[model samples]
Target: MIKSVAHAMIYVLNQDEALDFYKNKLGFEVGDDMKVEGGFRWLTVYPKTQSQLQLVLAEPKEGPLFTKDSAEKIRSLIEEGAFGAGVFETENCQKTYEELVAKGVEFIQPPTEQLYGVEAMGIDNSGNWFSLVQREK
Candidate 1:
């Protein structure tokens, strides 16, 4: 059985840009940044507070995971903001939203009261939407 969630993949348009966004803007630490055998880059970043779970920033290129046609399709979808990464928990949704906005992050929805907490919707550099939530106690 799997012990724990180690890494989650997020398809990116460019690894370098994604690195800048996640590391510089989102304040995540890079767990790994090495080139694989077949010109693939294994770049992963984790939140500063939680280093165990890393987000693998993968470029959808024609090599291992994608063929040329499929890679192009995936790229198109990413550009169109068709993917939702997942929910990201924050202690203060409003504060996080303001900080991210100051750093040039785009939020589709402002922080609003939800049944469970304060929630906001935002798009990352790769055109993936993520929910920023502050859970109620």
Candidate 2:
């Protein structure tokens, strides 16, 4: 049987910039930062609440998972906003949105009530769209 998702990978143009954006602005804590085989660096971060799940911030250049051309193509697609990263559930959408905005995070939409819940849309540094949602009681 299939298990729960362990992590999600996001290709970043610059690892350092992505690390800073995710850590400082978005409040994710660094999970791993180490060099592995073939001169590749493995970097990952996790949300403060979901510490068990890691988000890999991978550079798409030549390596095991991607070729140089493929990396460029993926980066281009991400820049064009063709990626949707799905929603992350939060305890309070309004509070989280406000806190993120205060930290200079750009949001595409403010907290609004929807059929599913109270949600807000935002983009990461690399242009992947994500929604922050809070279920109504």
Candidate 3:
């Protein structure tokens, strides 16, 4: 039986830059960063407060999981902003948006009041959009 999600994958153009964005800009801590068998880098990062769930920062490449053509397609789609990492929760959408913008993060939509909460849309370094939401009490 499924219990809970321990890790999720986020495809990136460059793992190093993604690491910089998630770790430095988003203030997520590196959970694991090591080269596993077959020279595959096993990298994961998580919010300091949410260490149980780690986001795997992976670079699409020609590997067992992807052929060269498929890898290229995925990479192209990522470059065109055709993917979204996921929604990230914060206590204050406006404040968090401002902080991320200050760190050179690009936002497509500023914080706006929604039926559920204040939400903002931003793109990661790899061109994947993610929502920042502050849920209403």
In candidate 2, position 40 carries an lDDT of 91
- The C-alpha stretches of model 3 lying farther than 4 A from their native spots are none
Clashing pairs in 3: none
Give per-residue CA lDDT, model 1, range 1-137, as digits (tens). 99999999999999999999999988989999999788999999988999999999999999988899999999999999998878899999999999999999999999999999999999999999999999999
RMSD of each: 0.8, 1.5, 0.8
- Highest lDDT model number: 3
User: Candidate 3 residues 1-137, lDDT tens each?
Assistant: 99999999999999999999999999999999998666688899999999999999989898767889999999999999999999999999999999999999999999999999999999999999999999999
TM-scores for every predicted model: 0.97, 0.90, 0.97
Ranking of all candidate structures by their lDDT, best first:
3, 1, 2
Candidate 1 achieves a global lDDT of: 0.94
Of 1 and 2, which scores higher on lDDT?
Answer: 1
Worst 10 residues of 1 by lDDT: 80-89
lDDT digits (tens) for residues 1-137 of candidate 2: 97787778887777899899989988889999999899798899998888878998887788887888998899898889888766778989999999999988889999999998899999888787889999887
* lDDT of every predicted structure (CA atoms): 0.94, 0.87, 0.95
For candidate 2, the C-alpha RMSD (Å) to the true structure equals 1.5
Candidate 3 clash total? 0
